[model samples]
Target: MSAHAINDRRHGQTTLAHFFFAFVRGPCKLLSSGAWGERCRLAKFGGECIHSDFHICEDAGRMGNHVASELPKSCDVENLWLCERASVVMAKFSVLLFLREQWTVLVVTGTNVGLGFEAAVHLAKLKPKRLLLTTRDEAKCKQAKQDVEQCSVTNNIEAWPLELGSFDSVRKFADRIESEGFPINAFIANASIATFTYAKTQDGWETTLQVNYLSTALLSILMLPHLIKSTTASDTARLVIVASDAHFRANKLKGVANWPSILGKLNDEEYCTASVMKNRYELSKLLQVMFVREPASRLPNPTPVSVTSINPGFCHSRLTRSVESNLVMKLMVHVGKALLARTTEMGSRALMHPAVEPSERDRHGRYMSCVEVAEESDYALSEEGKEISRRLWEETIEILAKIDPRVNQIISQHLLAR
Candidate 1:
């Protein structure tokens, strides 16, 4: 490291910027290439025309050894297509770096419309090698694929069918993904459903619990193995779980410390059959947060994967369609959409930030409240809270195992028996 970088670290402000440059420099060196002239690429493509954006010219070989001699210092050679892979392989060695080559394969659920669709549009601009757009309806997934591919000249965009309401269906979808042998870079758990009434899915769980949290948890576990296939040692595949700020509103978790019994208590037949699920959605969000926070500890040390939860905030999308069914509720949601809620596109920024950027290692198992890492609910802050999270994680694994023993096999292979 340079003395300037060491000194910058002491002060903190210049740390990431200095590290970023140094990180990129190491890989360019590996490619045995020198920086190019500012307009070198454009000069080849469009006859000496100049553009400020960094890009590569077709003929480095034609430039001969003069590549080093005719270079402009201001141009970033790191941005060239020539060094793309090397730079990507090395840039992530440091948590401070976010620069990466285009992801080879990425997955997004619930992409038919809403924040998932918005996030898909933004991701398309990055030009991932392949994009997996999933939804409950095959027709919707098809439309979403068209909508996403239209945003950029991306390579391959595929549509997959997923129904989160049934564990059996989730297991089948996950099994198909794992068996397909496609290298996955990131999995965006964006499929979620909200309900005002207490209803049970085919899996015999409350609708909100099954769809919003359990299905996401199961899909993430199944996808963990694929994420472990990152090409380089410095890199880790990302899991971006979209949650909501309503987590704080799950007052039922306040003062509860025993995690194993809590799910049972919440799932008691009498409780579901007799009660009106007023705060079920909020409770489900809280459970998702807990799952995100617990995965790191369960995974092997220096974890080969990074997990994070994102709150898109109170956004207006198809998510509001349920509330829209009631006249008064629809008016209130409409007002929220107009006056306070973020538009679907704007809210997708929450996923965009983590999806494209390499987050700080400290952020693993943390809640990303929008672009910032914000404090979680007080119910999640204590030592006992950690125990609760662990217990919930175990219960989730145990219960899901009864549904599919392969869940145990995957856990053992990736996180547990290692």
Candidate 2:
């Protein structure tokens, strides 16, 4: 009769249900190899098991630890963990399905192809009030809009133009969204690039730094007012940023210690070489994590808009196609993909999971991996990381304020002051 006793009884029931479904529906299959390194594509798709979609692994590592502690006498541990990972993701999606409803409005970027497109399709199925998909190319955006239309009954999906490489374009897009007067329930900053080539945006910043970090920070800040307006007593708006696990591999940059002018060091031509480009994307993602974390910390408790970054893991996408100029790098990437890549569909689930799932609102400013809240890189959590995050936040606001005066107004009026 006690609360603890009742909870334990329910957990026992759920376990029995999972085992029964696993056995009767079909054996959980390991469709591919590399359980951890690559993540074996588990054969639990198409709802093969009824309860497969109901169980979300709160602690992503819990199942792996469980499998390790109680490995079957003659079983392959890696394959077993693969099954666990597959089940966890599938279960997580089902939870989303259960919570599905007509969302007020949601926006996704880089939807011409890959994860963004796939995520748009999944979100469309929810039949939101409006689903805006943006891409840099008009023709491709139109085609993507048509493709998404065919997959779902949501007729409100619209394709818009957005070029992250230019701050003007980013500001214009935000202007249009704000002018529309519709409260944005969720904004997914999913567009990004990874290339060995060095270049600068029209804003005179490194291409990766501008597109992946600067422009993204700008748009998120510009849109904060709308996101906050959308929040109410019953629901809070969400800002879901598609970051990456590669942030863990990010090399500490010399520029970060430069304080207010850190962007200057990154923009220096010498620092943008093909060699330094090896970790360019990773570094940008680290900056993004820091950017999101600082703002999340500043927002008042019971925050109106919840900001979170997600690591969809490595999936097959055009994000790095521009690196074709480097044969050796291309070959290395090819092998890495072949060995360990999740489908865009799987990756998209990670992208949309936090956006639609109400439970994830509490994870403001946290990093999500495999659909669960996970710790960020050691450097990102160190005292040094804190200092860099502080400087990055100030610099971002400064630069954005120069581009659009609205940035300062939004931060001062919408977000908590330092």
Candidate 3:
């Protein structure tokens, strides 16, 4: 969906391969053969390439941009659309093939619209035993269920109410799932918000902190027992937390380390100013990247659960609607989306890759982008960041334990068990 055709032959850049990198701007794999030839070599993703008529093929690892085939010399920007379409179709077909034989139950959060709704529709095509969708609004939840039902062949789709702002609501939803006693094969935490306005949830924490980080951690921790219980010899349950590329921008947290508590400092009102609010959403996602790293280390080796985070790659979504009141921010989002944004449907495919793709050990605790394992921010991989992540994890568990006694019990029974 982020495809663009660059045809400035006057600039000495006229090859189809050059246009390929301009189209996706990320890692891609060669999908099929084209009229140009059967010997198309893949270039290293994000690497400098010397294009030469698409004749020379070089072998890189299983990570790069995927092209169906080379374009003919006579073709120009008009044929680039075919290459884009082939890339999307191939991605869909690849994921669907892995999911065809699966019959597991899946739970996707934040499914009222955008990435969540689109992911639910694709997951339903797997004919899972049950597909559960969660939304903050009941009417919208019902409408989403109907929409996904119409697109999918399965009739077992059900919509549920979940508000990430309230710990009580999160508890009730988890309790209902526990009562149902259904084995969950995957739980996709896709619901999140971004705003320049500063507000707190009914539970007393900052709105973005509670909805995006605290409550998300709470729900996923609560669901661990169910996820682990559902794992089998050949199949493992997956926990996919929808994080973001914005986390790379959260490099201003140096002062917070000197504070008594990390989460405490983040929740303080003084830190919620206009300039700070601009980066708060990115900070919350940074915490999520840590969440993926820390607790995953606690789980035993060869564990049956796969915990991973993903960046949906800046889709044209309703996530920015809350910040539209600020004219400056509104203009920025308008320009950003126009320049670099994928459609909601294409963005959802990245979300679906982790939910259904077959992998157990190597994929665990990894950050995926463009449907492949990607490097985290430089800070997130540093020693200081790891230390901060450790403290944040400790504080998060302690707070969540107070909210629900089951937090500690689940950690002991599921995570700590040897």
Candidate 4:
């Protein structure tokens, strides 16, 4: 584009922004409450009256370092600084944020260890605008940051504290990201836990389900707006869930036989007993695959983001070490390692392959195994399973919204009916 055209475009955007802010501020012109019991007489003079204290105009007024010693007679002005009142100092720090150039913000959860750590190291080499590496422990994250920085000096890696075991922690992390207003260039939901003892998070859900599926889904929804806006017409943003082919291995779920209505019962102690320990992990992955399908289906053609699940193919990670207490299971895992386990670096490639490269738009919801677009289980595609997936998505949204109100806002803002 020519410089003239570029200038024209910026001018048009600025004009439209001014008109938009004017429309918004028009109805917000109300009486500003004075000190304590006192009130402005602007309303008494038949001037515009705004009852709300959290006016965007007022917030925008405090934009620069410039200050005004007294109130301006009218809101109209060439510069916002000209209308400042009572030595108001515009907040320079906050205003500077708007002036900074946009950058790609990629998030990799559980980055303090294993596959997540390797992926963060790989992403760091790309020199992303900001790489948010998340782990439950602060000390581990501090170490993880040092390790990732070793890959590249200018890696804008920030270790964010996230504890998937607690609902409040997950909500807090998601809220902090939203408040920062970073565009989600890519979000990798890589945190998951496998437990043989059938533990539960503070939210009361089964530990495996909460860490692998529930919290990941909640974070995905919370980040949807940022993801959508960052996505371009030609190349959309990426949403990757580290799912496994173990999903197909899940069999004869007890309470889940009732499905949607009994979804909450998966956390029941009896339901998650030793007999079903490994099966619960498989079920969580299956639920994740189902989740991948629902959101892609809900989106319009040539979707703005890809929601994908991948199988790293029995990778050599500590995920399976949870069953070490069972001698037989431990022996199987030990033998399976030598026979088929991919190195963590190789497994990390499975995530990076789909993430960094562009694929056909129709591939948005597809399952991937070993860097190839592969088929999900028949049950995941069957009519009955589709119904279960839909119900699960709705139920998941309801559960997440109850945890944090922001989930609702993010979903409605980014997702439109096909």
* Best of the candidates, lDDT: 3
**Candidate 4, residue 401: lDDT:** 87
Off by over 4 Å in 3: 1-102
Q: What is the C-alpha lDDT of each candidate?
A: 0.65, 0.72, 0.74, 0.66
lDDT of 4 at 310: 77
Give the C-alpha miss distance for residue 356 in model 4, angstroms.
Answer: 0.8
- How many clashing pairs per prediction, in order? 0, 0, 7, 3
Q: For residues 1-34, write the lDDT of model 4, one tens digit per residue.
A: 2111111232222122322222222222222221
Tens digit of lDDT per residue, candidate 2, span 238-293? 99998986776677766566544777777789867767887898889989999999
**lDDT score, candidate 1, position 367:** 78
RMSD from true fold, candidate 2: 10.6
Q: Give the per-residue lDDT of model 1 (tens digit) for 1-418.
A: 3311222323322333433332332222112111111111221110223332323322233332345344455544324443332211101122222134444577899998998997887677656677788989788877888888886556478988899998878888878886788768778998887767776788788788889888888888888888888635656678889987666656545445643376776765566542336567777887898899777667776777778887776666888677568898788878756765645665675676565554435567777764456656655665766677777887898888888777888887777541
Query: Can you give the TM-score per candidate against the true fold?
Result: 0.73, 0.79, 0.80, 0.72
RMSD of each: 11.2, 10.6, 8.8, 21.4
lDDT (C-alpha) at residue 138 in model 3: 86
* lDDT tens readout by residue for model 3, 316-399: 899999998889878988987887776776677677767766665677998876566776776787788888888998899999
Q: Give residue 124's lDDT in candidate 3 (0 to 100).
A: 83
Per-residue error for 340 in candidate 3, Å, reads 0.7
Off by over 4 Å in 4: 1-103, 254-260
